[model samples]
Target: MARAPSSIVVFIRQNPRTRQKPNNQIRSLTFENKEGDCGNEETKPNPHREPSQNAQNEFTEIAKEVSKITRTKPRWEQTLLSDFPSFNFSDHRFLNEVMKHQNNVLLSLRFFHWLCSHRGFSPDSLSLNALFDALVEAKACIAAKDFLDYTGLKPEAASLECYIRCLCEDGLVEEALGVFDRLRGVGVCPSIATWNSALSAFLKVGRTDLVWKLYVEMMESGVFTKVDVETFGYLIQAFCDDDQVLKGYELLRQVLEDGLDPGNAAFNRLISGFCKERKYTKVSELLHTMIAKNRAPDIFTYQEVINGLCKKRKSLEGFRVFNDLKDRGYAPDRVMYTTMIHGLCKMGLLGNARKLWFEMIQKGYIPNEYTYNALIYGFCKIGNLEEARKLYKEMCDRGYGETTVSYNTMIAGLCSKGRTDEAHKLFAEMPCKGGVRDVITYNTLIRGFCKEGKIVESTNLLNELLVQGLQPSTSSFTPIIKKLCQVGDIEEAKKLWNDMQSRGLTPMVYTQEHIITGLYEQGYVEEGMEWLLEMLKHKLKPREDTFKRLVHRLLQRDQSDDSLLVLDFMLKIGYTLEKGIYASLWLLNFAKRIPDLPKHD
Candidate 1:
């Protein structure tokens, strides 16, 4: 007997050892299958008999020849017909021989095409299935689609459904929809499972619009005359993705009224949506309902609830839920532990956060970057830079590379504690230490420099910020503007103000107030009055002290007309003049006979 080729032996060995049949026996079975047109000893082989030696030799010769042809060139079609003119195209043995090179589906498909064109061959159901199996196995979705259309072969409905599912599973959703539409146009309704698979593919890719469209088409086309539980589940997901969670909730109610279990996925999605919307009450109600219905919420379900409570500044409630899950014997994963730790840190419950941190480590969950940054931010918020620094060092030692957030929090903490020099040192080290400085980094350093009255350093940083191509926000400009005004450099302050405007950054009341006060203090009373009027024109009320200071500065300069303008502006905004300012204004009015200020009603 001729030995099988090395490729064939290798292919046989790759099969599971649990198969009781030996390699020879498996290869024998392939020849026993039906051969449609090629002349054979019998159409049906005897079930009790083994393949004869001659049949084995012929199949081996075919495998060897096909392997040689596949290796030589792309134009194997002519060589294949010349080599195996009497080969059985419909035989499973031939398919198994050709599919040994299944890794190259193009070769297998071309061989199949050559068989059809030159040998006048037509594949049976089993042969077609083998082709589809190879195509799907290789994830050659586009090629499979073209082959199906080119041949105009109408595979059985089940085969088509399976192909649709394979198409969707491989993320070729648009191609899958084309197959689905073809099936529908031919008056074939795919199974509900296939429909759900298609629906899920759309949902996974966030094409909620297509999900709804297909669902409506599914209903209108009478594919599913009655919607099932899975259909309703997909509909709920679509509504949630569309941000219409309320409508999804109503549909869930309808599903419940009809006594169909909408399943755990439906419940989980609704919980996630409610969490994002901060609807903790609805989340709790659904959690209890899931438990009551014996559709017990999973880890993700509880995580959503805990995350929601934490976001609404309700960490206390979140902790309670976390404990409840623990009491139920569910071990929280690192992500869940991190969420609780973050919530605790945000609420300044450092004692609890520290306990959870140790507990997480003890429980064999390593802290990630988010976990360390959360605790670090909390420590920074409370002015406990030492603890934050220790945690940061540990985080670095543990190989959780220092993040921009960690650096920013530490820098801000140092600056807050009047350690501007240390903060600047760290800021300067960031780029060298593999840290990318963002706009927030420059803003923090600029504010720190302004706090120390280092006008030169602050301005240098502001210039560096622009050179770095970072857009400065209102925080970046406000402090520097105030500092410049305090130093009587009102011209630079005005320049920064205009620059801020040019950047389309709106000045908040703090920035406006500083500019207004700076103008008056630097003896630009008219410009100050004009700025104040600009604010008033926009219905922005300056601080009462700022308004009074402007009036005082104007009066001291003997600018009675400007003071009258100030009084008129203040009265228009419904401010009650101070007793001192009222008296001063009254004396001014008597001296100059300026128009009387309007009396408050």
Candidate 2:
């Protein structure tokens, strides 16, 4: 079922995914006296411009004998020189023949090396591509990386990039980077397409860690000319995908410096990335930057910024952006209005949350369950259980509270208000009585009991939940353990912690830290230290108070050595000690008459 290989003619043409920006906007970027160019321009070859049917027919026959000779002959040079004595080995067609057995990349490389070094000829891009494609198909990427050095860049700088493109297309990004590095090592500069290819490859492999360096190399090399916005979009999108929105901003600055106003699409991608990263301030910067380029913020941009701000609980700043969008004549859409309402509710700005809710309704936008649930949750959060009840009843009246999430939100609100009887009635009704029943409902009820200092009740219900074959997440156990610590029932908390581990569940870092703090406060310092080390094994650092408490206890016992050791452990775990902790350490160190402890950076 193997399809015939597409003629090499297909590759030299620009790929279909490449979009063209307006030519007038593209600016030429020049390499300013940088090294590695060897004073020669890398000539881009149109290797596939010709169909060359005659060339293919000749290569087909040449490949058969080359493959047979390569398998049987000790010295390919002697046999190749003897059997193909009349053949012009320097010609592109003959190189294509040698490259057909690209399965033996190292051997093909040897033939390629002998031909270039002895015969003083380089293979065309098509033949080199064949070699790379074979290596890529075999997934011998580590071998491909080393093969680049053996080929060197002396014969054809164009082929190096061609190989890089092939490697990138196949997701061999590391190999692509290796080839790109070799391209520079031997005094040859990479093309803009090669730079873009490596950037794309780095993005593919999720190595955004090194993407900026390659981009900087591309800019400084000056090998690139007439760079367009679409090309810049590729890089902006990559930075955005990796949640490195600042890098996207820097790319925008570079694109502007390159004299092209990156269009709204690029800005949108960065805005979305900023939103996802909860960099609310950067979202505002991106919007203003877009406006500076004469591009207005679109609906998606506003939606992302508002939602992002809401996530960070910066509803006031989100409101400013919402108002800004309105001022610019962009009528707030349903999503935009809902986002602001959700953000306000989350921030406990119930007054403004209600105002926006009514405003959106007056503007003919219908409130969805999200709008209602957010209002209800906000009311519940601010201790306005009456308003929360009213919103929940209104959501059902308006035919929007049929979903399990709506019921769960109402149940959670009631539980938070200590209306356990009402929450219980709602929870029971969720199955056959009315709505959907799920883990959140049980967890919420359990958490409510724990918060109300009803640990025995919470434990009984948890055991019942296991009896009903319901699996509990870490969240289900966290609240109980945290509440147990709050009540100083450390034995019960330890049993629950063990139960969670026995069931193969990983507890949250904050949960363990709380237990450790509780244990430490009760003078069980060794036990607390043991749990702290376990938390560290899971890559979780003890919170500031935990460290300070431990260090202070050591100092209280006049164990200055132990206190300093604890401080060093804190620093080793990458904690910047608090100012109070530093002052304590300074006093302790002075009293101990030791050389001054290392100063805080």
Candidate 3:
């Protein structure tokens, strides 16, 4: 049965699933006479409430007459004027009733315009909301927007919120944001829900930059008196994702001070950020705060702390935290064990590393390649090459695959012990053993060969590295350059030095020292001074010992002018010359019968 006309207002407030069923009743009105009076079935007016109730009845009757004429008459506004000549079309109550009852948005819009043309006709908030709700329900958003522009009315907060939310839902977030600004310009403050809708929309589209700017505007407006946890969560995650963790933390602090908890996910993000920045104090404080607030720190939380400590070279503190988690009955995962082992090995604490290694294995955690590599690295660090090799063999036997890192670690260990031949053999066997040789692989062997004074072999590897399209780093060239300088091949060293720059590599200070010393030793004193000035131009300082040797060589050659130039340039560029070198320059100047001593001022 169709409910009374009063139920139509309740229908608009219902969920879409139920609202679709009653809409027919809102449109069902039978006109029995030319006057368009609605057919009465059962609803009776109250005698005691006659004054206000009669007005409501009259408004309902006129609304039904207008809807009927709009549907059947081609010229609806002319028909409305002729039929209801005595009706107050400018009355707000009559406008609201007609907006609520009208089914066809186009016709309703025409009637609205006709009424608007009447003098003194103004749209109140209720009538505006009714029209917006109808237009939005009919998906006549363009028309609704046109209606808004036509009236030029400042919509109330409730109507603006609904409009903004609909725009956001339609994936028109930028348009919605523009609408929000226009509404606010007219002195309308949308509620917190409205702000959150726009915020959530931008966040969904991954526009955190826009979200942050809008949030700043939201704060500056001071309109939303209360910000819920969901809104805070959005801002927190957005800030953290943008690498603005400190700003995220400030928002979190505000959330906590508001006597609300942002839950574990937010806390974890802040903890992870602090870990990346190595802010252990803040991590500790957050962990403690989480526990105090009845939000327990999960395994990932402790894992981050351990990883951070290990990276900062505080493995002992990391171990303490690891042990505390175990004592508290929290099971450390394989990642945590590997992180601890890697740290302990780096610190050369082999004993503790071995203990943890055995414990992790006994706990039924199969050690992966990283786990084996960490122990291998520890063994290598301690010069236990046999044990390191044994671990590598065991890793291969267990089907962990021959990884390049394992091969590199073992090769580096062999090379460290002057086993260059063995290291080269391992390097050669890498391709057959499914190990891809990276730049480190070539650099390692190059460094090893240079250390053994096998310059020819190192040069061959450098050429092969270039042919394979592997970009060599400064480490790749520095050792080769130094080796050439040691063997009185200053010209060859200069060629390689220029080659490094052509390949877009900047030579380190050590590379400069090698070239300078090589030139001086080869009796190219002038060229050595030029390289020294080049170093100073690039703001590079050679080792103090190298500078001393260069100066003494200048004095031995009796090049007093070049030596004085070197000292003056050094002082000008703020390099403090050693006392012995300065005194030698003074003696050289005095013996040359020069008019003035080398100026110390």
Give TM per candidate: 0.63, 0.54, 0.58
lDDT of 2 by residue, 312-401 (tens): 777898899898788878889888888888888878788898898899999999998988887878888888888788878888898874
lDDT, candidate 1, 192-264, per-residue tens: 8899999999899888877977887788778666768988898898999999999999999888888889998
10 residues in a row with least lDDT, candidate 1:
16-25
Root-mean-square deviation of candidate 1: 9.4
Query: Root-mean-square deviation of each candidate, in angstroms?
Result: 9.4, 15.9, 14.0
lDDT of each: 0.77, 0.70, 0.78
After TM-score superposition, the amount by which residue 232's alpha carbon in candidate 1 deviates from its true location, in angstroms, is: 2.8
The residue ranges of model 3 lying beyond 4 angstroms of the native Cα positions read 1-248, 258-279, 558-579, 589-601
| Model 2 TM-score (2 dp) | 0.54
* Of candidates 3 and 1, the better by lDDT: 3
Error in Å for residue 304 of model 1: 1.5
When 1 and 2 are scored with TM-score, the better candidate is 1
Tens-place lDDT digits, model 3, residues 150-267: 6665666666777788877776788788888887788777788888888888888888878878887888888546778878888888887788888889989988998998988788
Q: Please identify model 1 stretches exceeding 4 Å from their true place.
A: 1-97, 100-103, 106-133, 142-160, 224-228, 324-330, 403-601
